[model samples]
Target: MNKRLLWLLFSILFMAGCSVLSSTDPEFSRENYDSWYDKGEYQKALNHVNERLETYPEDALLWNEKGYILISMEQYNEALQPLEKAIELNAELDSAYNNKALAYNETGEYEQAIVAAQKAIDLSEEEPEQFINMGNALSFLERDEKALEYFNKALAIDANAPYAQYGKGVSLYFLGKYEEGIPYFENYLHSYPNDIDALWYLVYSYDTLGDYMETIPYLNQIIDNQKENPINTVDYKGLMLTYAGELEEATTIYDGIIEQYPNEAIGYYGKGVLQIQQGQTDNGLQSLEQAVALDNSLKETAYNDPLLSSVYNDELFKRIVE
Candidate 1:
């Protein structure tokens, strides 16, 4: 009877060890969460976080990580809860306040974003990114002068900071110092050659300065880069085509984009601009009307675009405005 009991106890211990190996490995779960987040599967990442949190509820960094994923998913209100929870657990978690500021910015709570960003800056170990975040939040508040100060502060900390350079460029651009803005953008692009935001702003600054010829190289670079990542290519291509008087090519590109993404309003708006540039008034009006109907954001620029000047006096254009 004693021998039989000893064998049974050994078997039970073996089974318990296997069960522990299968379920409670923290490294495996952390890696799984990272993979999901990288693939933009935020909900899956959150589920993983939930499982992990069951075991490590006091982990402030994990809560901050979860908050960032929620912010990326644009679940701003939902993100605030986790971010606030993280801050409550650890007031020194700079990333938590930084992510919370982003969420607040997305929700149009500019003042809240400013406060959060300031808190993040105060808590941050690394000064440059924190200053950049504060500058961005201030920009959203239309405190351009204050924003410029923080951007300059960031640049003072690290002149090589691409984000700080970009922020300074934007602040200068909005302050009507286009010439001053151009060099900062160029400096940023020097370090981050594939930065689309820097490329786009360089084109805008060149256009504003009426150096349209200088704009061509950056625009071509953007188009070429799009072969690898096609997010902003259509806009860059359309601008170049418009300036080069290659309306037919521009129209083709815009049509192809619209076919692939019918709900995207920019393609329709671009097609309208190209049509109006070619003196096809009625078709251009129809495209612009469709664009404005699909997305009101396009309406803000409809009247100001030079390509649409031909149809500006039309009844349809008046109706669109009304």
Candidate 2:
């Protein structure tokens, strides 16, 4: 699935505080199950649901709950079974259809996701989730204009809908209306100030407009977040700095990356590009040679980039890329 969907799932699972769902039996309580689910105890929640299902075998709600928990755990394939069962047991379960759409979307079954979301919308036109789901499916299918329409429909129903706001921004960005997409991402960031997804779009939109300086704050936010979780390897901050003509700051970032990850070729590549752009042809060529030696895959990129044109016909540059 796309990063948009992943961000939505994380927001739902973490931000939607433990609200208890209605249960048929007093014995099959939500208290214990909700506590487990809220604490990221998927296995415990699954066990509880399995035990309850034995006594309440026909409970469509229980099956749906199980499916929802499974989706939260990212067990999309496993989630389908319970969600499908919930629909079979009670065809009118609109929420079950929505959950099913979520599972299908996660698995890249966009057509099935659209069908399930349409079913949910048919069952309950008042809910914004169905529209958001449909929009997300359309976005993934590259029907960005159609996706924007659904997102607008959801926004008409609830102006403050975070998913709708985020969807509108994403759809507009995908449609190449990057300038128009900025406000929607800003609105989303108002609700979720530190959300990496919204910040990423802000960075991208500004960068696309050739206003790389405008991307700094958002890039800093992402850089700060990466400190908390370092799996992110992309040097967006450095790239933005280079684009904005902040060569010193960009070089510092590249230097840090090389110090931290000595063998990674991208750091050297970025440093080389920056150096060449700043007219240090000899030093840049040396760095580029080191980068190519580490990873020859970047040779084509280095050869074609306009910023390196000054040395395009240079003997050393030709040797490095060729």
- Write candidate 2's Cα lDDT for 1-322 as tens digits: 2545543443233211121335575566667767887688988888888888999888878888888888888888898999888878888888888887777877889899899989888888776788888888888888889999999998998898887898899998888899999999899889888888788888878988999889988877777776463413347778878878899999998998899889988889899989998989899999989989899998998989887888989999988888
Superposed model 2: Cα runs more than 4 Å off: 1-23, 27-36, 227-234
Which candidate achieves the best TM-score against the true structure?
A: 2
Question: What is the Å distance of residue 144 in model 2 from its true position?
Answer: 1.4
Give the alpha-carbon lDDT of every model: 0.72, 0.81
Clashes of 1: 0
TM-score of 1: 0.59
Q: Can you list the residue pairs that collide in candidate 2? A: none
**Residue 90 in model 2: lDDT:** 81
Which window of ten consecutive residues has the lowest lDDT sum in model 2?
11-20
Candidate 1, 30-142: lDDT as tens digits? 46655776687878887777777778787776677677777666677888988888789877777677777667766767688789878877766356766676676677666
